[model samples]
Target: MASNFSRQEPWNLSQENLQEWFQDNVEEGSRSFAVESNKSMDDLVRFLHNMPDMKTKGPKAKPVKVKEVRKGGSIEKGTFYKDGSDLDCVVVLNGIPKLKANTKTGKYRRGHLKPLVEKVVTALQQASFTARCEKVSNLQLKVYAKQETGGILEIDILFTGNNLDYNYIDDEVTMQRILSTPYNTMLNMPPKSQRFIYQPCLTPLQTEFVKSQPGNVKSLIRLVKYWKAEYLHQRQTEKLINSYTLELITIYVYEEEMGSPDRFDLGEGFKRVLSLLAYKLGGFQHYWDNFYSDETAQRGMKLKDMMKRPILLDPADPSDNVLQRWKKGLGTISEIARETLQTPLLRSIHVN
Candidate 1:
């Protein structure tokens, strides 16, 4: 394992106090937030499942199934930001009407995708917990709700089965197999296409990859996410950075710069990641072979916007650059990173 602490000045605190600070601030705070938010997520999941629009009435009718709220929102990742936390929930709609089969091609016409997503939106708007429906997309709907404790909760309900009739319930295995397929075979088109067509199908794989990461790495990720949230609050600017971008960078720092996730000083480890951001860490790209290949990642890398300074490849979907949207804000983020280093404790972060 390679370490990057050689040039940095050492902290004055002993190891015991550093560990105590992390536990009180990052770890305990994150767990507490998850506990409260999860109760609301459970209630909301039940409300959505019981909606008339979500019900199926026929011999083939089955109970509506809601996938677990995986990734950052889950307790495992502890990724709640200070001002607001985004919870991602994946739901599979059963007994949805299939598109009219094309007589000429004998393939299912997928024109019903939009209507189904709209249907979901309408149902959620009518649901009791939803304060307002914020945004609706082709595959997901974003809604806002006020927590009983006076916090704001933003939920993104992803209909995994709704993308152009590529229903997961119908053929999951075949769709998932494509994630591991060669990059060229998956997309034969020009490399400039930015659409992550296979994102929905690969959700499970993404969740699992994050879940299986070492515990220490997850802690480091949560700490960086907390810092980024504070960084934005101080500037009071538009939301330029996504939590996922920092999560990947944290992983890179731990794997490449900090030697190993198994052993490290928590405060020093965090400072190292912040230092990387302060310096605009770039040049090398990273990918995991858990779901894709190096050759495939190399090919998929062509689609990313090279003009962007730092490129962090999505672990599950190599063709997508998770950091692309945050490119313009790198300079500000670097400055913020420096400011965070001077503080002994990161503050004003709300978990709810």
Candidate 2:
């Protein structure tokens, strides 16, 4: 006998079918931004690559070497919502001066990293592009992309020091050691704290994780993100939740309820995710150690103490509890899901 789930056809909540709706609206959302952003990114990368370092000594002076340009955030994840206006890029600066060791903390001071990031903003402004340094807890250089119509695009340039120690290795032990190395560290300070410290680096692992997912899985993420946006707008709350947290939650649902991505359905995936949010959201914890070591996984389990509910460990950086501070907003999502599921038309699609 065939399994009922295997025989079920795709269902859509809207008047038009789900596939058609996605083809007409959701999938088409990122096209314009993708094209315009690509041109600006290329121009900026070229400028950054060719810019000379004035501080270099006379005879041996050479242009700065930008080792890598890694794309991050929703845009890179292929889940950017309709009318999304921001793009994130991480540029690794090679040959940065190491920070002096702090005698007090027995660790290196990260004050030097900020100045290095600021120099990026200076170069972009000098290149005659509309760029400026945004003052925040982290060093982010904001460049306004040239746009003929629609809202201006904001490109967030996150600077990270090059980690030559991070070689291409499959060994878990070797990888964990590299992640903990000083070369992979980036400056991170808690809000209203005088104490500045280095946080573990963010590589392209998260990007690749999402990118590796099948197209339907990516569509599932976009659905949750779009719903979250609508939920936040309806509530008019000041507290903002991380989009990455929602993405992980969606991934968890797809893996647990829907099985493999090969046969994943958009409507069914959306139902499982919304069901998780609606029903089992409180005290939820799901993780996998695909990218990190078992020891890192054990260490990450302790970080759950800080999280309220719906705990999720960031796949790349274990120290980050992606859903730590999303308590009230999550409740709103749960309530919204419950109410939406109660609708007569959506009930059959959402229910098991």
Which tens-of-lDDT digit does each residue in 49-129 have in candidate 2?
676553222354334457677767676777777553336777776664433233223212243345555566666766654
Among all windows of ten consecutive residues in candidate 2, which has the lowest summed lDDT?
Answer: 1-10
- Candidate 1's TM-score reads 0.74
Q: After superposition, how far is residue 252 of candidate 1 from its true place, in Å?
A: 1.2
Give candidate 1 regions above 4 Å deviation: 1-16, 51-78, 81-84, 93-110, 162-178, 182-186, 189-194, 304-309, 342-352
Candidate 1 per-residue C-alpha lDDT over 1-352 given as tens digits, one digit per residue, 9 for 90 to 100:
0012212212234444667766776677677677767776777777666655443334554444333333334443455543435577766555544222122111111332345566667777777777877446666678786677777678777764432332233233464455544344434434433233335545555555566668778777776666556554445467767766677677778877776647776667777887787774565466665556666667666653432435677776666677776777777777776665555332211111
Q: Which candidate's lDDT is highest?
A: 2
lDDT of each: 0.57, 0.59
Model 2, global lDDT: 0.59
In candidate 2, residue 125 scores what lDDT?
67
